[model samples]
Target: MKNAELVVIPSPGVGHLISTVEISKLLLNRDHRLSITVLIMKLPIDSGVDGYINSLSATATPRLRFVDLHLPQGDSASQPQDPSSKSKSPLSFFANFMDRHKAPVRNVVAELTRSDSSSRLAGFIIDMFCTAMIDVANEFGVPTYAFFTSGAAFLGLKLHLQSLSDDHHQDITELKNTETELRIPSFTNPVPVRVLPSVVADKAGGSTMVITHARRLRETKGIMVNTFMELESYAVEYFLNSDKTPPIFPVGPILNLSDGGDDIRTKQSRPIMEWLDHQPPSSVVFLCFGSMGCFEEDQVKEIAQALENSGHRFLWSLRRPPSKEKNKMQLPSDYENPSEVLPEGFLERTTEVGKVIGWAPQVAVLSHPATGGFVSHCGWNSTLESVWCGVPMATWPLYAEQQMNAFEMVTELEIAVEIKMDYFKGFHGDEDKKPEILSADLIEGGIRRLMMGGESEIRKKVKEMREKSRVAMAEGGSSYNTIGRLIEEVMNSIA
Candidate 1:
């Protein structure tokens, strides 16, 4: 019989859901006395996490339960409003969407408590975006712990900025256009304003919502960051040293390396693997942006030219941009004919040296022996995956906290190559404004340096971090010990 029960609430996106599930599995595997119930919140549009959820349910233990919250009919939470409206930001939309689920979530918690006599409801583990659910946890008189799907450095940045705004009463919106550098405690170097997350840097967008979430983090029982101390020693140490922040646990490098199942491997990913099988080991440069990353025709052509000119074997996952129709969800679609966006005759010319495909098997590709260098969007999950697989990256951050992630890896960690530190493809309606295009020459230079730099220090560092990542997840590692401490605290809360 389970002794203690934990309810986990995760945000809708696949990246967030994947990390949340991995962490939950880690906790369940570590302590037999613990049971977890994950509350699923569906996205306004189909983000394709349902298949993954179903697979998990098929293999899940009795102690692990998934409860899907019922959405009210005609409830439009994540739908985009008028651009001129104050609630136009996507961050605000997501925050509001999660806020609407408070009633259902509270009811679910009440039911769990009522149904189980043997199991005690220990706490609520909430996703970073689900901070509003803390209110539900409070109503039940249980502590809430935040599962930060991002790295410790980004977590520290959020807390520090929130403190500056709330405690110091400073107007952080003024920092959007300023060229000044701010010295953050987690970072070794002065951080430039341009490298800030677009949500925080954009004055008219989601800065308020972002700051609100950071403020709520301080109220949590403890914050669990999805990064290992060995990888982010300084940031982890910074949180440990600061008394103002709640107890911080760096229990990660938490990754979902599974490519669904064998059927997916044989059907969807066979071609990609077959191609990689032929390439010389560590000869191909793999370029794949995250799920939401895509570009226009102009940017697409520049990248094609760069790959062709670089004269290196390459595997590129190029996606078509989402529909421009008003009130439509902005998700990347697969191109019917990629040549329409590429330079004329480009595919035929480079067919021998490269392959351009849509919807890559990212984890499988990263783990492949042939994938030497990665040209990535630097999403936190992608960053951790690259490190876990020992692949060096050339960073090209498109949105969210990715620019800051790129800055940390390149400038702070010195493990990744820089493609463009401050590349911001604006979120929500901001994409309408034409962002500066990266030229082919600059792209080619980054690719060449990443691929042909020849046993460089960056490569060596990534290899070393890969080993450290393995050690952290092993028995008696830092992340293992941190998880143990977290479980102990939850058990103690029962007394």
Candidate 2:
């Protein structure tokens, strides 16, 4: 059991934590000699997120252990005002937390390697946000792998764009003065500039985050991404042949389908799942944004109106936007009660056709036989889960690199239908005036196209990709070989 013990540290976010845990599971699933211990960063507040991680860790077999690394916490002023909200910005605040605590993590690694002789240090597999841990692995002469929890196209685009930032005189992560589209090697189509992540859109603080990631990822031994080769072969092949990139591995579609967590079921998931169980096969479109995704009151009403007009079966998870006092970062607004916000008689009129919950069990909902399409914010995890479940999507990205993910899914991959790709960009941070919201007509059109209209080809394409998603993780498949190769490389270094 002590022969090949690997250590992984994940950033504090639940999404990152979940992906890292799944990756650790993949690494030790079939390898009896391998064991893993995950060092989780302790956040400042009692958000229940840490408790969720603890619960999942408890369920992991004896080979996997999760421990909290007593690292320094962020200043109270810097942390989110809402203790329980999952909408913390991954790039800025979390990055600062990791940067501040780097020395503690390094010291921990050094101590483990120095004291533990029976168990060999396989390497440090860290969240991309937690890239500081890589230096510790290097200092102790052990390998480190960056665990990218997004799609490979995005990873390839990141590397390609980073190279451009380095070689070009201008900051490529920032939108150039006249730039309308970005031409990345990983993507065949030129992506519209308006849809890039906040890293590209905001050139000040966000630029530092993007540029820093570009620089740090190159320094790791290799990268392990949460995608399979079949879904991202075009980008994977590009990375493999490029002299610029380190070795790349596609060891995912690392999915966590369970609906349980720390004894909290989000209160609304039960009725939603029960409602789904009674629906006809492949008849419902499930709409959910990630923890961070939400819309203003008008936007929520517009979405409700659109759902009313689409005439298709639907399940929409709504969470109210953090109240102004609680919206510390002034992030976007989320909806809570669909019926309360809907036009009078609207909820009753659509009651038979659609079900709206304040929160839904996303993975379980997506995997259900009744769900045929997903209306997503395109957070990488949500995108992968939809694909892994073989559900097609209607893309409606709200923030961060989600627009980039939406662009990849709709244009680069043809698996999703785009509704309002760049609708709110101009108004996102603008304080003077109200932004033009996406209207019901447009949302209705997108839902119609995605669920029952002319987008049969997209449905078919997603179906095919879903099959490949499964195949890639099977024995002798692309992901299997990639993970095997990655582990072999790590084991060889220690021997």
RMSD each, Å: 1.8, 3.6
lDDT of 1 by residue, 1-495 (tens): 349999999988677888999999999998898999999888766676777787676678998888888777777773545445664565667767888899889889999999999999999999988999999999999999999999999998998889888899887888886798998898989999989976685566567877899999999999999999999999999999998999999999899898554455447688999999999999999999978888889999999999998899999999988766654455787788999999999999999989998888899999999999999999999999999999999999988899999999999999998989898896532664678899999999999889965789999999999999999999999998999999999998896
lDDT of 2 by residue, 100-185 (tens): 66776777667767876877888888888777777777877777789998877888777766677777756764473455777788
C-alpha lDDT of candidate 2 relative to the true structure: 0.76
Count of clashing residue pairs in every prediction: 0, 4
Candidate 2 deviant stretches above 4 angstroms? 45-48, 72-92, 173-179, 266-268, 327-338, 424-435, 453-455
Residue runs of model 1 more than 4 Å from their true location after superposition: 78-87, 261-266, 427-429
Winning model by lDDT: 1
